[model samples]
Target: MDSREMPEPVSGHWPKRSSDAADHHPHVDLRPDGVTVRLPTPEVDWPSECDVTLARQISQAARELDVPADPAALQHLNVAVDALVIPEVLPFWRALLGDRDKGPEDLIDPHGHGPSLWFQQTDARRTGRNRLHVDVSVPHDQAEARIAAALAAGGRLVTDQNAPTWWALADAEGKEARVATWLGRD
Candidate 1:
């Protein structure tokens, strides 16, 4: 059966597309809370020349679905924590949080109720500050816009050592988070 016939969803609507054309579209993730419409790489600056093209394609596909597109409900988030000893300490966190292994360095809430936890490898632990850092993964195309939005809200850029992938930023009080993208990651 095609995606449309996968089953009428109980919560979220999928943007309809022809089975052959489906490969060109973003994925629609149906969750208990809401739905996330995501591309392999997020497009942040909507209305840009490139984004406009993508937007049109999505709009067309969404129109075919006969469902009102709700861009407002389309944001996805992931939390990442930097760690000095992933091999030694990951197990502790897994047991404490009752998380299951997603990979060699990641743990996930099997029920999808909690933010996904990814352990980033770091050489040394931070001295005074907390070692845990939050990483917000968005569609790759949305990274710039998300970063700009954060900065506009008083978040400071800590480092852009990795661009189009992740940008380390801190809040007014220096609490840290990174706006991440799937680019260069997979």
Candidate 2:
């Protein structure tokens, strides 16, 4: 089936394309909460035609089996490190993290088992705050709920200027995390 005809996810397990197109073979992780499905690398930022076809097949099979999905639980996590000069620090992280594949400003785990590492460029180094933070990317429809849940759990809203796309939040102790979504991304 084509992308236009692809079915919705059956059990919160919609297939997402890998960031790198060179890697083939879907990666399926069975977690206590649910399964996470990643389609073989796509040719572009989004899933390719073949990836969609495969997703449709997977969805169909899941439907046939009456599997349920919890879309709210779907999320992708990554670590972000602020760097004044990426090139100067990239190698250290690359070597320390093993042989992760490098993107323009990120290091991705080739095996898809670890959280991707993104390097954020900064003009000036800020004092008294951690240079690294965790970014949690959830489905667009679930971003608000997740943010609210974090707030309820003692996290404060650091910034919502990028709302609907991302919100910077901090724990009571000031450790930061970002709740993000695909919205506002092209």
Candidate topping lDDT: 2
Error of 1 at 45 (Å): 23
Score each candidate by Cα lDDT.
0.62, 0.71
Q: How far off is residue 134 in model 2, in Å?
A: 0.7
User: Candidate 2 lDDT (Cα, whole model)?
Assistant: 0.71
Which residue runs does candidate 2 get wrong by more than 4 Å?
A: 1-25, 30-34, 39-61
Angstrom error at residue 11, model 1: 9.0
Q: What's every prediction's RMSD, in angstroms?
A: 7.3, 6.8
User: Model 2, range 35-130, lDDT digits (tens) per residue?
Assistant: 656663423333455555665566665555556555676677789999999999998999999967657677888777778888999999978888
lDDT of 1 by residue, 1-186 (tens): 123423356223334443224444545666544445544332221223333355557556555655455443344456667787788888998898886767788776665456667787988778766677787766566788888999999999999998877899998888888887656653
TM-score of 2: 0.74
Q: How close is candidate 1 to the true structure, as a TM-score?
A: 0.65
